[model samples]
Target: MKKLLAAALTGAAMLATPAMAQADEGKIQFKLLGTYVMPDGEITSVNTDIVGLPAGTQTTASDNFVPTLAIEYFVSPEFSIETICCMTQHDVDAVSGLTGAELVSDGKLIPATFTAKYHLNAGDVKPYVGAGATYFWWVDAEPGADTIPLGVTRTTLSDEFGFVVQAGVDIALGDGGMGVALDAKRYFVGTTARWYAGDTLAIETEHDLDPWVLSAGVSYRF
Candidate 1:
């Protein structure tokens, strides 16, 4: 009887281990993520006047695989708050009636979001959707002609507010609370792109700069 009881108890202990692990995995956690954004659109300055030099199209771009980080905490199984510290440096280029110029605008952007997440039934794969807001400030832009001139008050995006929509999924790890996840978000960053030389201000275009973000990383549930 003692030998039989010992074997049964060991089997029971093994069964309870995985169940306890799953329950503890529900705890809130943090993650560090990296992202790469590919810009596929153009921000242009249009000519309002029927005469004079025509306005031009300027392209903004970033180097491959920009570095970023994300942290997440769950208030409940269905809700969470997340924040990211990521920045972009765009090379600005223009060509207007055969006249060409270039410059750079670099800044750090922080996105803080509160989201309502619905976990899937399958514990191995969890997919969720979220919506939130964002704020971006033009931290530094080079001082030069043809670029957003330095210190032009409100001409550049000193600090602007916007909205964010995101989606992602988390894949479970090997019998652990740590796993991999993929996320993507669309940010509608309201812009204030201005051009003025002397008294004439060109089209004061408010940019609806919508950028797409894609990222993947490992996460842990504490």
Candidate 2:
């Protein structure tokens, strides 16, 4: 983690040293984009006695494809603050690692994020990098009727705070006011999730909700 931060700061300093011209200072940019989220980890269950499963039961969440938006305010041609938002619903299915049986057939996850980026604008091509935090409004899972009868009923994820890193490039579509952008963000937020059967607590454990979000779309500068 320390190494990563050091690398980012070094890169930013190198980009900032050229005394580049600032043509787009104070402009607001908006992007309408299609985003795809690929989650690359699992959620594990610890107290399996409540669910009748063994220890270390890992569950994998599904990927998401949706439309999203980003609003940015350029502090200067070399820097900007942006917020990315979309209300997305994801279905989560939990498969027992040991038995390979599908446990929770139904579940959902929702999230939103904000960022501050530094842009290295070199004429028609703009390359940028950023770091920020993410706030998850909702994350939960519920088992099917068959699983409820087996003592493992539902799972709920606590709201979490995580760090985010982003890197992307913007290509001029025509002139200064329009462009096409491509970016990717990695979120490092993993929190403990809980599983329950009615009023009975089933399992409590941590899971990596860390996801890599890739986006591409059109941006307009005003």
Q: State the C-alpha lDDT per candidate.
A: 0.61, 0.73
RMSD of candidate 2 to the truth, in angstroms, is 10.7
Candidate 1 lDDT over residue span 78-164, tens digit each: 577777777765544443342455533443344444444555536678888888877776665542344444322222444677788
lDDT of candidate 2 over 1-222, digit per residue (tens): 999999999999888765433443237989999999887447643534544555545666668788988999987777889998876555445565444454444445556788999988687798999999888766455664445566765667678888899999987776557889899999988756666767777767667878898999999887
TM-score of each: 0.70, 0.79
True-structure RMSD for candidate 1: 5.6
Off-target runs (Cα >4 Å) in candidate 2 are 1-26, 44-48, 95-107, 144-146, 151-153
Cα error, candidate 2, residue 183 (Å):
0.7
